[model samples]
Target: MIATDTLDTPAAVGSSAPAATPALPRGLAGTPDDKEMLRSAVELTRDIATARPEVYWPDMLLSAGLGYAALAGAILIGNPVLAALSGVVSALALYRALLFIHELTHIHKNALPGFRFGWNLLVGIPMLTPSLMYEGVHTLHHARTRYGTAEDPEYLPLALMKPWSLPLFALVALLLPIGLLIRSAVLVPLGAVIPPLRRLVWERASALSINPEFRRRPPEGEFARMVFWQELGASAWALFVMWWSATHSWRPLLIGIAVISLTALLNQIRTLVAHLWENEGEAMTVTGQYLDSVNVPPPALLAPLWAPVGLRYHALHHLLPSMPYHSLAEAHRRIVRHLGVDSTYQKGNYSGLLPLVGRLARSTMLPR
Candidate 1:
């Protein structure tokens, strides 16, 4: 089970007098007043924070259905025009289904047991992105001490890095399918038999991480069981894909791979603008972590398409990591409506993804 500890820091929308940064963990500190204010704001929105089992089931089922139907129609139907139309739809639906993994990491275990198992069976195993890869790694990204640091497995300060790194960052997702396949088909089996190799795989190969130096510890207890089952499913899927391609026809598997690649590419773009990337591995104040994060608020209709699963309000998420996905917009609305324009919360809102990316590019290229 995931840790359900309440963060001591408050996640409020209103601004108050600046207080001295209170002592905190090695990499994070923030004013107690700030924490308290946020807590008050959060309490106001607490009713909506509970997960809705009803919403998750239909959404996953429909997206998975659309993705599979479109893919099958595209591959089996011989018409070029119909195939093109279906292919585009297939890519988007598949992307949405895969995106649900982000939500899986945050959802309360008791809330959606069947969805978790179904997700692993449908999108996770076939796409080579099992929940095990993200279960432990993603939580660290929200840790007050690790948000912008090298230790945060999911983080890398993209804007602060060399300009060349940006293109490499976006383009690298195209190679992920191959990499994931290698991890499942080659490394997983080998590591199970070899003791030394098992350590290396657990630490270096298991996580879905952006930080090159970050390493994960092997899971114990229930998490270890999760890893075992998920890895078995993914390995079996990978083997099936290989056998299917060799025996049947490559058309369907190729189309599925294309959709998965497209999903990764789209996710990579979302990750690019997720943060300002201003902190250079510093243990930041809680407020500092809030400032570095981004929220592409409404009027950007496309924002949800690219950063769905409640990711559009990313900064708010940093403030209240335990809040359920469906409730985030209501939490954001409640915070902003009550706090007004002058609030520190306003600092997290950006106009759109392109503007955020443009600002980061300019920040990196132009003299400060």
Candidate 2:
């Protein structure tokens, strides 16, 4: 223990791994009490699934209720702005639900075809906005949260970018749009040109159970392919919706496109903000759980909305995806106590965002 403490001291930074963290850190969110929280969360999830798994019936009903109220506001008072705003919020909700699907994607829950259909039909449509190709890359991010030379699809290597280079930062912001467009428009369709992607997904899904290779040692050239497939799926979905509203004219269609685009921008900005403190080549830690994800503190009503996609209680999400979001806070509490470390939560310290920005500006000069 004394040796571990000495090595963990700052003087040993460049020499070797901290003695306290022999093989990276363990029990990040799965702290001493994690087993208890997991047990409780699992019991609840099982009940929910047994009674109503498919369609997330309870949640769908709630969304529908919200939608109905929004619809009433739209048609009764002819308040397009209010209606549009509600649609925007609902759209985000739907997107989060799709993210929930991602939580289940690797779990091998194929036994519940009904739940699959529900999530796909409800959440799938909105998720169409983000290319699945991009999403498939997420598997890589989860597989290998640490920095490596191989570019993980979810690799947003901004942590090490020059802190003073606003121009470079701006370039990244600019590419967000281009990347979205190309992924939606070009890459997706081109994927069909090659028949190997399905095999890749199958490979990834299988590997999720054991190898953890998808994220750690990313597959060659698959990231590009993932973006391509997403483009194809999103374009087709977008066209379908536009056609449905065709008689409503291209104006609303254009407006919808604009709205989704703006939302994407917001999403991108949020993602960048999360990893502000991440140093390239640093091992993934509990802090990265929320630092690499969106944070939401308690007392926020919208926390529930964020939780479905695994962004809510980020600490637990990192440690155990199977632990439903509802139990994340308690799990995090226990883990922090056991590990004697602090990780980012949904809401962060006031200064967290600012230092990140300043550091980001000067990051490129940093030693990797």
Candidate 3:
């Protein structure tokens, strides 16, 4: 899930209004009494947090390979029916592959070196979402003091907003490709030439954030060099896309951008229901965070496609942020079997996305 982030400035290019002053949702706004149990459940899942290359590498490779293949087929075949078909397939696969950025943040720096490099080289640069965009931003979302507060870069209570806000929130993904392109091609290189503009671009353009007010500081040391190279790679790719469009053909680049746009849209839909969106800028307990978040359990097979890469267990990931993606399901199962359906650990589970999103939409319509 691309977590909700509140921007301080005007909403980014495709966004609706800057997040309005947040209102407290009417239900479940306080700390839960079962904090200890939630903590214990998280502790129990800690053992499974180790990243395994065999598991991570195959999924990453296959998703990237299939996604590029589908896009290539779309461009080469030049049939409207096949193009649309392949575009959807490409979007799904690429979205899943790109989500590994979330894993990269949570994984220890020493782990998954090859996956890191390969992901940045393929999906990250091509999609214009290199790891640097997420590296420093995501950790703030997990901070205990900041999780649901105004200070948290990745949180906004969409359920508490006006009814009109829902569509804007979900549809903003359609605008991300244009926004990212301008940020990389125009802003990044320009910033390098003009020293003072560097900070402005870094804060406003560097991260894939929802928070307009969140300012990313300049990277230092080795990470600084990595950010420079990543930006160069994306900028170069952006130029190549332009060159391809001008010289040989626009079909390939257009299809690639279409896939990226669709990837963002699908991710936006997943973000919409990742949580209840119930936090009202309050400091939430570990239990509060779990209850305020959500999971779509078994038999909801479509959950995997929409919320791929263990995002189907979003609430559980929040509970045990260190747990690897492959291990989330087992951790969830163990908690359910040991703690039973009625456990506070299970409070975040939802039957499906529709009810959760519907209930949130309805909640915002009624007077608070």
Candidate 4:
């Protein structure tokens, strides 16, 4: 079982004395916990906590199916305008499908039965992003002591970085498709013959982490067995695609890469605003992490298209990491209704993507 930290219970809502606050270095430390608000998040949302397989199965399958169908249309269609439109549709759908990897990371393995394997076969391996990349890695970002610290694989102090870093970060995602192809088709297969190379690839190249210094620990037991198969499947698929492109047609492969590149670019932009990215290297309190993270809640129509699944409520996810995506909206609603407008819970909620990105960009301009 995954270990969770007990929240520091503060005085009730509207209490004169505030919650305990942690002292940290320069950067946004976020507001102290409203213990009542945190309790309400758990108590009020219990009914909706269960992951509904009915919802999970159809949504993932439809998204993957639509993505591939649209990709085929993009490749085969003669007209430039129509093909471009098809490519855009393909990217958006596949992007949504790929993000199920995030869900796979959080959900209990038994919750959805064969959902993980189904997703790997349909979307993960085909996209060259096996669930192994995210499963063990993402949970660390939620670890109480690790979050916002250098130990967190997903946490980077981007808001504290130089202004050039933001654009460079987004631009680099354009090359991810090519990078994955090389890693799976070339590096991984080569690692089988070279033991040191195998260790380095597993430690360095296997995870889907943004932190430059984060090296993954080796997998153990069932997870290690799972990784071996996932690597073999991905490598086989990658090699087949490369050989087929060489023998048959380069057009299909190039067009597929282009579409996936657009998908990667979309995800990179969503990631930019996932957090305020202002924690530096501090070991933030749970409330502090929630505040530093963002929630692009409703009234933002375009958020669901880009930040699909439950990602729009990323801040809320920090609060309730085990909550399923389909239940987040209802959870947000219940918590908001209980806490009222003027609460620490409401503070994390932002208007939309551009404003959040603008906030981060402006933060970068401040003297470090």
Whole-model lDDT per candidate: 0.80, 0.44, 0.82, 0.92
Q: Which stretches of candidate 1 lie over 4 Å from their true place?
A: 1-33
Q: Estimate each model's TM-score.
A: 0.88, 0.56, 0.90, 0.93
Question: Looking at candidate 3, what is the lDDT of residue 355?
Answer: 87
Q: Tell me the tens digit of each residue's lDDT in model 3 across 75-105.
A: 7776889888988998898888999999999
Pick the TM-score winner. Answer: 4
Better model by TM-score, 2 or 4?
A: 4
Go through the candidates in order and give the clash count of each.
6, 26, 7, 0
Error of 4 at 359 (Å): 0.7
Predicted structure with the largest lDDT when compared to the true one: 4
Native-vs-model 2 lDDT?
0.44
Residues 172-226, model 4: lDDT tens digits: 9999999999999999999999999999999999999999999999999999999
Candidate 4 residue runs with Cα over 4 Å from true position: 1-27
**After superposition, which runs of candidate 3 have C-alpha atoms over 4 Å from their true positions?**
1-29
Report the error of model 4 at residue 354, Å: 0.8
TM-score of 4: 0.93
Question: Which of the two candidates, 3 or 4, achieves a greater TM-score against the reference?
Answer: 4
Model 1 lDDT vs. the true structure? Answer: 0.80
lDDT of 2 by residue, 1-368 (tens): 00111234443657765456333332222112234333443443443223224434566546544543543443444567776776566445444543454544444455445554454445443335332333444445555344221344444455555554444434444333334444434444454565565444434521212113443233348545644443445668655654677656555444444444544444444444444434344444333443444444455455454344445454345445555444455555554444443432322322334444555566657685
